[model samples]
Target: PIEVVGLLNDLYTLYDAILRNYDVYKVETIGDTYMVASGLPQRNGSRHAAEIAYMALDILSSVGDFRVRHAPSVPIHIRIGLHSGPCMAGAVGVTRYCLFGDTVNTASRMESTGLPYRIHMSRSTVQALLSLDEGYKIDVRGQTELKGKDVEETYWLVGKAGFPRPLPTPLHIKPV
Candidate 1:
C-alpha cells in the first residue's frame, strides 16, 4: 500500500501548506477526502467564503503537479465543493470538533455531485465571493438536485477574474 501512503503524504503536505496561508481550519480528512471551513469559532464574516474559494483553487493547482509514486504517469485530480451559510460547531464525544446543520450537508452534496479537478460552489458562496471582491470567475452549473435539499443553482469556480482565459495549463510532471 505504498502508493496509498505516498499519495496521502503528498496530499497532507499540500493541505498543510494551504492551511499556513489561509485562515481556514481543517474540519477532517477521511481517506482521500478533506474538509475545511472558515468563519467558525472566530466568525470573519464574508471573508470565509473568499478564503475557502481561493484555497480550493490553490489545492486544484497543486494537485495538477502531483504524481502517484506508483503511477507517475497519471495526474492526481481532486473535486472540491463549497457552501456559505451558518452552522453550529462544537466538540463531539471527547475531543472531536464537529459541524452540524444544513450548510454542512449542502456542501457535502456539492462535492459528491461535482466533477473531478473542479470546484463546485453553492449560490451563497458565489454571492459571498462577489461581495468580497476577490476577483474570482465562476461558471454557472445550473440547477442540480441535492440530497435533503431541493434543487439548487450551482457554479464552478473558474479562476481569478480578469486573468487570461482558459487559465494556465496545470503543471504536470513527466512520467517516470
Candidate 2:
C-alpha cells in the first residue's frame, strides 16, 4: 500500500539520523526490515551493545508519533532484535556489503518472534550491555525456540535504569 511505502520512507529517514548518533553501521534493508550492527569494521568493545540499545529505544520512541501518509489513522509499529557476537563481513558485488553468520540469523529470529514496538535482545547482547552499563533497564522475555536453534533466553529493553525523561523531537522529512 502507498501508506506502507510512505511509512517506510519516513522510517528510513529517521534511521539515518539515529545512525549518526551511534557507532553502529547500517548493514542493509529488505523491504520494511532494517539491519544494523556495532563493533564491526572497528571493534568498540562492550559499548556496541549500549549504542545499539540506545538506537533501538530512540527508534521505538520516534515511531510512536509516525503516521501513515495514506492512512493517518493507522499507527506504524516495528519489532527490533539485537544479538552480540562475531560475524564475517565482506563485499558481495560492486559496493554491496554483506554479513554472514549465525549471529545474523539469531538476531533475525529475535525480531521475527518479537512483539511490535518492542526491542528483543539475546542473552549475549544483554550481558554485554550490563557489563558496560548497569543503568540499562531490561526484562527477561523467557526461553523460546528460534528456528534451527533450540530454546534460548530473550530479553526486552525497557529503558535506562533511571527515571524516564521526554525524548527530543525526531527529525521528520516532508514527503517530496
Candidate 3:
C-alpha cells in the first residue's frame, strides 16, 4: 500500500505553497490521486486559465525535478487538466463554502486524460485568455472531444515569458 499519510502531507504542503503565490481553488486527495485547481471563487477576468496553467506547469516541473534529484528510483510525474467556464460557487454548509459546476468536471477530465506535466485546455478557455490579453503564446493541439462537452479545441500552453507573436504571424501550439 502507498504511504497515504506522507502523500497527504506532501500534497497539502505543496498545495499551500502554490496558493501563496497564485490562486488555488481546492486540493483533494483520494488515495494517491491529487487534484488542484486555480481561478475560482473570483475570476480575475481572463487570467484564470493562464494563472492556473502557470501554476500547474511550475508545480509539475518542481515535483518532477524533486523526484529525479532525491528519489531517482521512483519516477514521479503528474498529469494536469484545466478548463474555464461558468460555475456557481457558494457556501452551502455552515462550516465552509464549496464550489460546484460543469467546469469542475471538465477540468478534472482535462487533467485525468492529459499527459504528464501537460496542461490540457479547452478552446473556450483559450479564447477567454485571449480576450483578456493576447500576450500569452499558445499552440493549437487540434480539437478534442471532452468527456462531458461535445467537443472543444485544445491547446498546450508553451509559455508567457516570451513576447506575444506578431498579429500577422500565425501561432502553432504543440503537445507538451
Candidate 4:
C-alpha cells in the first residue's frame, strides 16, 4: 500500500534546514538514498570541498549525540564523500539544463562506498582539506581506484571541531 507522504514532514523539515545552511550541491532522493554535494556551480578552488566535508562530519556527530540524548529509539547515520578536480560544468538540454563532469561521477562513487557516519574523499580533496586553517583528524586510507580515473588515493575524515593536527595513523603493523 502507498504510504502517507506527510509522515516524513518533520524529517524533511530538518533535512532541508541542513541542506540550505551548508554548501549543498544537487540532492537526489531515491527512497532513503540521500545524495548531496558541494564545490559545484560555484567552485572555490579546493577550500569548498574541505568545508563541505567538514560540515558533513559535524552534522553527523551532532545528529548522533542528539539521538542518544533525546530519541534513543531512532538512530541515524550519514555517509558522505568529497572530491576535487577539473570537471566540465555545463547546462545540458534547453528546458532542463543540468551539470555533468568526471568530478561529479567520482564524488558519487566515493559516497557509495563510504562507511556510515564517515566522510570519504579523493586524494586531491584530502590534500585540499589538509591545507585549510582548521584542524582535522584525517586518516590516509591509501590509494584506491576511483571511477573514471586511472588511479586515485582516498582519505577518511576522522574528526573535526577539535584537535590541533590529525592524530597519527592508528594501525598495528608487524614485519611482513
lDDT scores of the candidates, listed in order: 0.82, 0.82, 0.63, 0.63
Among these predictions, the greatest lDDT belongs to: 2
Query: Would you estimate the TM-scores of all the predictions?
Result: 0.87, 0.88, 0.75, 0.68
> Number of clashing residue pairs in every model?
0, 0, 5, 0
- Colliding residue pairs in candidate 2: none
TM-score of 1: 0.87
Report the C-alpha lDDT of model 2 over 13-44, residue by residue, as the tens digit.
Answer: 98898799899989899998899999886789
RMSD of each: 5.0, 6.5, 6.1, 6.0
Q: Which stretches in model 4 have alpha-carbon errors above 4 Å? A: 1-12, 65-74, 91-97, 145-151, 163-176
Q: State how far residue 169 of model 4 sits from its true place (Å).
A: 17
43 in model 4: Cα distance from truth in Å? Answer: 3.9
In terms of TM-score, the best-performing candidate is 2
- What is the lDDT for 147 in model 1? 80
Model 4: per-residue Cα lDDT over 1-176, one tens digit each: 12223424444455666667677665455555555556666766656766577666655655554333244576555567777777665666664335467877888878766766667788777777778857766787666666566656688888775633332322333212
Per-residue lDDT over 98-143 for candidate 1, one digit per residue giving the tens place of the 0 to 100 score: 8989998989999988877778899999998988786888899888
Error of 1 at 16 (Å): 1.5
> How many Å off is the CA of 118 in candidate 2?
1.2
Q: Write the per-residue lDDT of candidate 3 for residues 128-163, one digit (tens) a residue.
A: 767867476677867677766676678866556553
Candidate 3: residue 37 Cα off by (Å): 4.5
